[model samples]
Target: MTSFAPDSIVLNRKLPLWYQVSQSLRASILGRSPQDPLRLPTEEQLAGHYGVSVLTMRQALKELEDEGLITRHRRRGTFIEPGVQRGAPVRLLGSVDAIVAQQSGMVAKLLEHGSSPVSGELAEYFADVDEVATYHRLRADERTGEPTNHARNYVRPELAERIGLDDLARWPMTKVLRDLVGVRIGRITDTVEARLADPETARLLQVPLLSPILHYTGVTYDEDGQVLDVAVIHYRGDRFSFTVTLDAD
Candidate 1:
């Protein structure tokens, strides 16, 4: 019996009510602990919780059912699919330390690792080097084993040699770079935007084709102000939210 606060359900009047409600419910489903039972509240109860009509709640549940997230039976009620929790919508916090803390419990699986020639868009970042090490990894919630992030990393050749597969699978790249590789980080630049997932992305993330995703591009620079790594990470749009707070002077 997972519950959410009324304030937690922020509905944007500009968006379709059903869509917003579905997303909010999806977040709750994914955020729930695996130890919890699969059963969810009835449509009427859920509708009451969301302050939407039964019809609207039914529509929202249908969306989740169609996505293979949940199954419904007139007599059995609704049960979420096993091993399907996508974790909560991660709030992208400021500062490397905060970001690292946010990623603490995820389990990483190394997908691909090798050295590639520096060319195309990455050429500018590694202009001085002829080749760079590349890795592709899938990160999932340790508790539920539901995939949440797919990342491709391009590391500077010099630093990449010291990185081990075991480290990559166990820790975030930022941690590997700082704690293991002993690199001094001078700055990190990140840009986030919405994009539709391609076939590969959808397969890795267990989401539908062309589903909206949060695309993140990050560049890490060393103490000398040279690019140390370039990372591209993709997150399910429904499973993440970026947060930033500004202080008024």
Candidate 2:
């Protein structure tokens, strides 16, 4: 039997308790399994485990069933759908892990690559830096030709000329930061916010005008506290999500 990793699941207070529980359960279901009939804990048992009502647990299970990740028979218990483990790639975010793509079936299409002096709100992020410039802009799509994400990347002015569009299309910015700029990564900070898609953002992401979007901004800094790169990536709210792990003080 596959044991659940209790420590890996935490409920987010920002969302409804049922939604949070459903997401937690969904992660466990994604792991590959070879058991003939995978068995999930009873609704009452799960409710007791999570300290929520059985009604809340049923709601969470309903979400999984609606997504075709689980099935409930009249007499037989719930089981994970046979082939769901191989579904669309799930995006996971972490401080050290960064972006881990199982595979790059998603093709990158460069839109515009140019350089301009940083201004306004961006100036605060790279404080005391002489000059910053835009390095790359691209949108990515899945093998099925669905838009996945749109990203705008920036780097120090000194590296603007060295890092070109081809480089952006080939590999991730982390590689460019290490090879081109010669900076040993120390830490990464990520901030996620919700926003409404604008005209340009809508076109790039293929989302409806004014649709909900996830705005993610990350800043990479070296050991000396110097900012190395700044990235602003947008993900479709429906097709993508992020997982964050927090430890209690």
Candidate 3:
């Protein structure tokens, strides 16, 4: 079995010193104090412990803050944000199917279903395709009654054409891919970013603008690494945190 190593910071001339320091601290927090939400070290304490200037420590903290890994209060001090948990560290593969399967009682609603040409940035993924293929768009919610995430997925026409959009209101798209499409997922590539919810997302998620949201861009492939589907999911920052394990080897 091929096991991937955890991502880490390389302390070299190629990167800035503050960034390297921040990465080390972030890794420590993710690895050590995940369960204790309020266990973040004070900025001054961190600077003294790491043998860095207070400014450098502040810079490190700023980087973590930008990544949504930590939060700062005026006088209350810095703390880990609530509900953000580290997830298992695996290859960037099969994440969608795995996540949906792990979380029960989640529901998917098919918002739009159709076929269109792959254009712009998406065209690069399909290669040599002129006409638009079948497309499946869905909104997946992670809550029983109140939705915790709003996800949109796009798949190749041939793979998605036969699946009924109406079926999503009842079952997750992953199930449809398995039962209707008959494609066994092999790998997935995921890109994560933190952004404020848009107006539509804010309204649908019942949150105000500037509310934190985690955007996930994912692509799933078959056993032979054939592209199966691409998905974009938005999760409520206040409700969830992605987790991954890292080992120092």
- In terms of lDDT, the best-performing candidate is 1
lDDT of 2 by residue, 106-147 (tens): 456777766666777688777777567775455454325667
The list of candidate 2 runs beyond 4 A from truth reads: 1-95, 100-105, 179-181
User: What overall lDDT goes with each candidate model?
Assistant: 0.76, 0.64, 0.60
How far residue 2's Cα lies from its native spot in candidate 1, in Å, is 32
Cand. 2 TM to true fold: 0.59
Worst 10 residues of 2 by lDDT: 96-105
Question: Candidate 1 lDDT, tens digit per residue, 45-103?
Answer: 88888788999999988977986778999988988876544454444333454344445
Write the candidate numbers in order of decreasing lDDT: 1, 2, 3
lDDT of 3 by residue, 1-249 (tens): 222121233344434557567656654454332234454667777777766788988998897787676789988888765544433122222234334432323444545556667768676666656544443333333323566667666676667666676556554455568666678877667788889999978877777887998888777778987766777777777767666533332
Deviation in angstroms for 76 in model 1?
40
* Estimated TM-score for each candidate: 0.64, 0.59, 0.55
* Winner by lDDT between candidate 3 and candidate 1: 1
Off by over 4 Å in 1: 1-93
